[model samples]
Target: MKAIRIHEFGGPEVMQLEEVPKPLPAADEILLKVYATSVNPADYIIRQGGNDLLRPLLKLPMGLGLDASGIVEAIGADVKDFKPGNKVYGVPNFPGDGGYAEYLAAKATQFAPMPHNITFNEAGALPSCALIAWNAIVDLGHVQPGQRVLIHGAAGGVGNLAVQFAKAKGAYVIGTASAHNFDFLKELGADEVIDYNTQHFEELLHDIDLVFNASPVRDQSVRMKSAEVLKDGGIFVCSQLDSPFPAALLQVLAAKNAIGTMVGGGSISYTSSLHGTTALIEEGKVKAVVSKVYPLAEVAAAHRESEKKHVRGKLVLEVAKEN
Candidate 1:
């Protein structure tokens, strides 16, 4: 099996596609012949070692990818929910050899049946991003219908899904993005879209019941501003799992009596989140937002694009064709 592995952290150029031994299922795992995977900010961030302190913690020569959609080639003795040839999609274990390979052997609990309404490339784009969005809006925020829910970076991978998920939950969804994406966010069910380029969101909106910061941009200013718009006793959710909640932002939330929480990639149940997203997709209430599809060999190119931080949706890597 060929996999993209980075022996040392640096640039997208560090990712190399090489012949590697195929992985086998563990006692509670499933071996999947991956049809596709998607590029995420985390992919490029991890490829470059995230930061100085984190760089030392990464094991060199690891595969890069968090999402996968494919057919089950085999299952472990302990995995009875799926059989050989089942179509599935989910997040593979992070900080390990990932889904950017011809095959993956991951814990069966990390997966769910792929949404029947989407293509392999689309399914590949959903798992990690959708899980993050679900965790933020559903689990942490506890958004309710008619609540004013604000989402930052509404045009990005997780942001777009967050908008849809919030909408499906009956919240009045508001999104912040560049002016060019205003229409796109609205199409994804945002009741209102603010252009972050020319307008400040805090100045325009108030009494927001929930604020979800899903943007990849690391500006603490967004966090402070987001804290301002929340209604008293509102919820503020952060998606930057690796970063701590700043004291200033915490103070802002405290002043408003708003709750502040951070969501991690693995903080929620993968099976349940994927199942919820699948239900939405199959019911036509949600859609996969794929920006581009790259051949698995062009992973380096995809990384370059993801590093730009301007991709509207996910950039997918085609690993194999569904037969």
Candidate 2:
């Protein structure tokens, strides 16, 4: 088996595609012959050594991905929900086996049946970011019908999905994005779109019941300013994922009467939140928003594109086909 692993973290250069023994499923896991995977902010962050504290604790030589879509080649003795040839998608939290590989052995609970009508590429583009959106919008925000939901960075991976999820719940969705993506967000069910490059969203909208801050420093880290538009008792969930709150963010939230907290969706609980999107995918109300696809061997190029942060929707890794 050939998989990408890192001996040291710094840049995409750290990821090495080398021969390695294929993993075998544990008694509670499933073995997947990976068809596709995806690049995420975490992928780049981990490769670039941004997680300084976690880096020292890592096993040194470790795999470098989190989300994948594949076919079950074998199921563990205790696994009953799937069998050989079943298609699945999952995000197994890293520091474990990774997705940028030919095969993966992961806990059965981390995976779900891929929606029948979509391609492996689409499912591959989900898992990590989609689960984040699901957790922030559905779990943390507790969005309900007739609620007004505002999503920052609404054209990006998680924000795009957040818009759809909010719409599915009958909330009036408003999104902040560049002028180029205004129409795109509208197509995703955003009732109104604000061009963050030119307009201030908080000035234009108020009484928002929920605000999912998906922007990573765009609008200069608006978590605090975002509270200005939220209704009293509303929820504001910021995704500072795998990092501490942008300095003084907690203080700003503390001053508000609304429920405000950052969403750390990369944990094991992300797998459970994925189950919610699985339902929406099956209902055909939600799907991947992939903007590009690259071969598995070109993962470095994918990382570069993700780092640019202008990628619409998501970027996918075409694996089995590349092999």
Candidate 3:
């Protein structure tokens, strides 16, 4: 099998396309003939060794991808849920990343049967981003009907899905994106769209039931601004911890008897959690929006495009050509 591996951590140039041995499945795993895979920020973070805790666990010369959709070529002896010809989509576990290749093995629990309505490229784009949005909004945020939810970076992968998920829950969704994405966000069911580049979101929106920070803002002062728009006891969830909070903000929350919490790490347990995303896809409430596709040899270019931070949706790598 040919795979893209990064022997050392650095820029996009470090990713190398090389011929590697095909992976074999464990007793509870399945070997997939990969059709497509998507690139996520986690892939780059792992490649650049940005997260120290995950760095040590990363195998040297590791394969570079997290999400994939393909046909099951073989299944381990203990796997009964899937068969050799089943279509599936899943995220490979960290420290064993191998999606950017012709074939890779994943625990059966990490994948779900692909929906019949979508193409392989679209299926491949859903696992990581959709799972993150599902976990954040539906699980942790506890978004409900009639609620007002604000999503930052609404044009990005998770943002696009987050908007749809919130709307599907009957919430009035507000999204923050540049001017160019306003129409796109509206089409995705965003009730209100704010141009973050020109306007201060905190001043324009208030009493938000939930605020989801998907951008990479890490400053403490900057992060606390989201609290300004929250209603009393409202939830402020952020993917990045480096958000700024004012002392006055804490006082306000304390006076109102409200709580604030920050969360990171969308890594699924690869057990029961993956099933939830699968069900959502099958039900047609959620959809993967693939913005671009690159061939196996163009993995480096795909990464470069993702780094621009202007991509409207997910970017995928087609590991195998269609028949």
State which candidate has the highest TM-score: 1
| Whole-model Cα lDDT of every candidate shown, in order | 0.90, 0.83, 0.80
Ranking according to TM-score, highest score first: 1, 2, 3
- Model 2 lDDT vs. the true structure? 0.83
lDDT of 1 by residue, 169-236 (tens): 99999998998898888888999998898988989999999999999988888899999999999999
**Candidate 2 residue-wise lDDT, 1-323, digit = tens:** 99998888788888888999998899999999898899887788777775754565467678878799989999999999889999888886465467899998998888888878788999998887877888888888888999999998899888999999999999999998889998888888899999888998868988889999887554435776788788877888887654556656556556667787777633536456777788888898987898999988999999998898888898898888722
| Candidates 1 and 3, the one with greater lDDT | 1
User: Could you tell me how far off, in angstroms, the CA of residue 264 lies in candidate 1 after the best superposition?
Assistant: 0.9
Per-model RMSD to reference: 1.3, 2.2, 2.4
TM-score of each: 0.97, 0.93, 0.91
State candidate 1's TM-score: 0.97
Candidate 3: stretches off by over 4 Å:
217-219, 241-256, 263-276
Better of 1 and 2 by lDDT: 1
How accurate locally is residue 189 in candidate 1, as Cα lDDT from 0 to 100?
Answer: 90
Better of 1 and 2 by TM-score: 1
